[model samples]
Target chain A: MSFIEKLKNAWVSNNSLLCIGLDPDTEKFPDLFKTMAKPEAVFAFNKAIIDATHDLVCAYKPQIAYFSAEAAETSLEQTIAYIKTQYPHIPVILDAKRGDIGSTAQKYAAEAFERYQADAVTVNPYLGLDSITPFTAYRERGTILLCRTSNSGAADLQDLSVDGIPLYQKVAITARDHWNSHNNCLLVVGATWPEQMAAIRQLVGDMPFLVPGVGAQGGDVNAMVKAGKTADGNGLIISSSRAVLYASNGDDFAQAARAVALSLRQQINVARA
Target chain B: MSFIEKLKNAWVSNNSLLCIGLDPDTEKFPDLFKTMAKPEAVFAFNKAIIDATHDLVCAYKPQIAYFSAEAAETSLEQTIAYIKTQYPHIPVILDAKRGDIGSTAQKYAAEAFERYQADAVTVNPYLGLDSITPFTAYRERGTILLCRTSNSGAADLQDLSVDGIPLYQKVAITARDHWNSHNNCLLVVGATWPEQMAAIRQLVGDMPFLVPGVGAQGGDVNAMVKAGKTADGNGLIISSSRAVLYASNGDDFAQAARAVALSLRQQINVARA
Candidate 1:
C-alpha cells in the first residue's frame, strides 16, 4: 500500500494522531542497559516501548542521528524490523532531514527506504527540488519537508520574507503545488508555532503534516490540534520524543511511556472535539 | 590543528584546492569489487583513490549517503581513519547536509565528529541558529552551509527575494555575520553559479567555500576560481566526484582516478594563476 493509504489506515485503526519519536540516548538508559551493549540496549528499550504503546500511536519515528551517533545502526535496523514485523500497520518515518544534489540524494533515498525500510523520510528544503525529487520518486514512500521547525532559532531564516510571504509558507505552498505531483509530499509544521501551522494548513489544504514539538517542547496541544488538524481531524501526526521515551529512567519506563502516549492522544482528541 | 588550518596547510603543501568526493555506487564498481563484499569493495576503492591522489588534493570528502545506503558505515569509518592516520594534514569533509532541532543536532554532531571523526561536515542552513549552534560549538571543526547549490533546481527557493536581496545571499550574509562566532563556518557556493559565487565572496569576505559541480556537472573551473577565491587565493575547495572516481572501470582505475584528480587540480591552479 502507498504511504498515504497506510497513514490513513493507522489514524483510523489506532484512532490516534500521536507519533512516538524513538530518539535513544545511551547516557540516559536505565540500569538494564548498563550491563548490555549499546545497540542491544537501544533495541531492547525500543522493543519494550513499542510493545507497551503499539496500540496507542498512529506511527513511529526513529531519529537517525541517535542511532548513527552510537554506531548503533544495527540496533536501528532491528528496531524498525521489529516494528514492521509486529505492528505491520504503523508507518515508520525516518527523521533524517537529508538534502544534497541529485546523485547524492539518490543514495540518501536508498538509505532511508532500502537500508532501513522506512515508509517516509524527512528532508530539508534548502537545496530545493532536485534534492527532493529523489525521495518523492519513491511513489509508495512519503517525502516530508521541513517547513517551520520547533526551535526558537527557527525564525532566523524561516521567517525571512520571500516576496511578502514567510519562507516557511513559501516552502509549504511550493511543496503543495510544484512538488506534490505524486501526492506523496507532506510538510513538517512545528506545533510550537500554532498560528504558522494554521496558516500553512490553509495554504496546503489537506496535505498531512508531521507535527513535532508538542510534549517535551512545551507546545500547547490544544492550539496545535485546533490549528493543524484537517477537516476530518486526521492530518497531524503529532510527535513527542523525550517526554514520552524517558518518562522514567526505571524498569517501568515502558509503562510510563504508555501512560504519556495515552494522555497525549487523549489531549489531542479532546482538542479535536 | 583547526579544520581551516589543516585545509590551508594542505593547499600550501599540495598546491591544489581540489577535494575529491568519495561517493561509491556499487553498480559502477570495477570487476575487482564484484568479488568482494559491499563494504570491503567501498573501503578498498576509497583507499586506492586516496593513496593515488592524496598528494594532489587538499581534502577528501566522503559523501555519507554512499556508505549508509549500502550499510557500509564501516567502510566510511575506515576511509576517514585511513586519511587521518596517513595524510594527517588533509582534512576530510563528510558531505552530509544534516540539520535538526538543538537536542537532535547535538547527536548529529557526535555522529559526524566523534563516530566518523570527519574534520568537517556539510549542513543545511534552513533551520536557523539554534540548529547550527551544536555544530559551531565544536570550535575546531568546519561547518559548511549550503548557499547556491550546483543543481538547476537550486534557484527554486534560493533566488527568492528576501528584503530585496536574494535568499542565498541572505544565507551568506547571515553565516558570515552571525553563525561564525568561532570562525569555523563556510559556505557551499556552487561552481555552476559563478556570478552568484562572486557575489557571495564579496558578501562573506574571505570565508572558505566548498565548491562542487566543476568536472562532471559542467561547472566552469576558471569562472569559479575567479569568482570564489579569497584574497590570498586560498578559499575554495573545488570538489569533483564521478569524473575522478569513475574515470575507469578496469584494472587501472586508481591510476585513472589519479590522472583525473591531477588534471582537475592543475585546471584549478591554472585558473588561480
Candidate 2:
C-alpha cells in the first residue's frame, strides 16, 4: 500500500495522531543497559517502549543520527524489522533528512527503503526537485519534505519573502502543484508554530502533515490539533520524542512512555472533536 | 588546526585543487573485492583509491550516504582514520548534508566528528542558523554550507527570487555575514553552472567553494576553476566522484583513478594561473 493510505488507515484505526520519535542518545541511557553494548542497549530500550506504546501512535520516527553516529546499523535494522513484524499496521518514518545529487540520491533511497525498509522517510528540500525525485520514485513510500521546521532557526530561511509569500509557503505550493505524482508526498509543518500551521493547512487542504514540537518542545496540543488537522479532522501525525521516550529514567520508563503517548492521543482526539 | 588552514596548506603543498570523493557503491565495485562482504569490499576499494591518489588532492570528500546506507560505518571510520594517520595534512570532508533542530544537530556533529573523525563536514543551510550553529561550534572543524548545490534541482527553491535576489544569493549573504565566526566556513557551488558559480563566488569573496559536478555530472572543469577560484587563486575544491572512483572496472582502477586526479589537478592549475 502507498504510505498515505497506510498513514490514513493507521490514523483512523488507532484513533491517534501521536508519532513517538525513537531517537536514543547513548549518554542518556539508564544504568541498566550499561551491561550490554551501546547500540544493543538502545535497541532494547526502543523495543520496550514500542511494545508498551505501539497501540497509541500512527507512526514512529527514528532519527537516523542516533544510530548512524555509533555505527549501530544492526539496532536500526532490527528496530525497523521488529516494528514491521510486530505492529504491522503502524508506519515507521526514518527521519534521515537526506538531500543530494540525482545519482547519489538514488543510493540514499535504496538505503532508506531497501536496507532499513522504512515505510516513509523525511528529506530536505533545499536541493530542489531532482534531489527529491529519487525518493518520490518509491511510489509505495512516503517522502515527507521539510516546510516550516520546529526549530528557532527555521525562521532563518523558511520565512524569507519570495514573491509576495514566504519560502515555506512556496515550498507548500510547489509540493501541491508539481510534486506528489504518486499521492505519497507529505509535509512537515512544526507544531511549535500553530498560526503558521493553520496557514499551511489552509494552503494544502486535506493533505497530511507530520507535526513535531507538541510535547517536550512545549507546543500546545490543542492549538496544533485545531490548526493542523485536515478537513476530515484526521490529517496530523503529532510527534513527541524526548518528552515521551525519556519520561522516566527508571524501570517505569516504558510505562511512563505509554502514559504520555496515551495522554497526547486522548488530548488530540478531544481537540479534533 | 582549523579545517580551512589544513585545506589551504594541503592545496599549496600539493599545488592542486582536486578533491576526490570516496562514495563507494558495492554493485559498481570492480570484480576483485567481490569475494568479501559488501562493507569490507567497499572499504578495500576506498583504501586502494586513497593509496593511489592521496598526494594529488586538496580534500577527500566521502558522501556519508553511501557508507551509512550500506551500514559500512566500519569502512567510513577506517577511511577517515586512514587519511588522518596516512596523509595527516589533507582534510576529509564528510558530505552528509545534514540539517535538523539544535539538539538533533548536536548528535549529527558527534557522528561526523566524534565517530567518523572527519576534519570537515557538509551541512544543509535550509533549517537556517540554529540547525547549523552546533556544527559550527566545532570551531576546530570545518562547517561547509550548501549555498548553490551541484545539482539540477538546486534551481527549484534556490533560484526563486527573494526580493530581487535569488534564494541561493541570499544564502551566500547569510553564510558570509552570520555563519562564519571562526573562519572555518565554506560553500558548495555546483561546477555545472559556471555563471551561478561566478555569481556565488563574487558574493562570498575568497571563501572556498566545494565544486562538485566536474566529471561524470558533465560540468566544465576549466570553467569551474576560473569561476570558483577565490581571490587568492587557490580556494576551489574541485570534486569528481564517479569519474575517478569508477574510472575503470578492472584491477587497474586505482591507477586509472590516480591518472584522473592528476589530470584534473593540472587542468585546474592551468585555469587558476
Q: Every model's DockQ, to 2 decimals? A: 0.90, 0.85
Model 1: residue B17 alpha-carbon error in angstroms: 0.7
Q: Which ten residues in a row have the lowest lDDT in candidate 1 chain B?
A: B224-233
Worst 10 residues of 2 chain B by lDDT: B222-231
lDDT of 2 by residue, A116-171 (tens): 99999999999988898999999999999999998988998999999899999999
Pairs that collide, model 2: none
Candidate 1 local lDDT, B63-149, one digit each (tens): 999999999999999999999999898999999999998999999999999999999999998999999999999999999998889
Per-residue alpha-carbon lDDT of candidate 1 for residues A200-263, written as tens digits (9 for 90 to 100): 9999899999999978899999988999999998899999999999999998899999999999
Docking class of 1: high
- Judged by DockQ cut-offs, the docking class of candidate 2 is high
Model 1 scores a C-alpha lDDT of 0.93
lDDT of 2 by residue, B47-89 (tens): 9999999989998999988986787888888888888999999
TM-score against truth, every candidate: 0.99, 0.98
Residue B94: error of model 1 in Å? 0.8
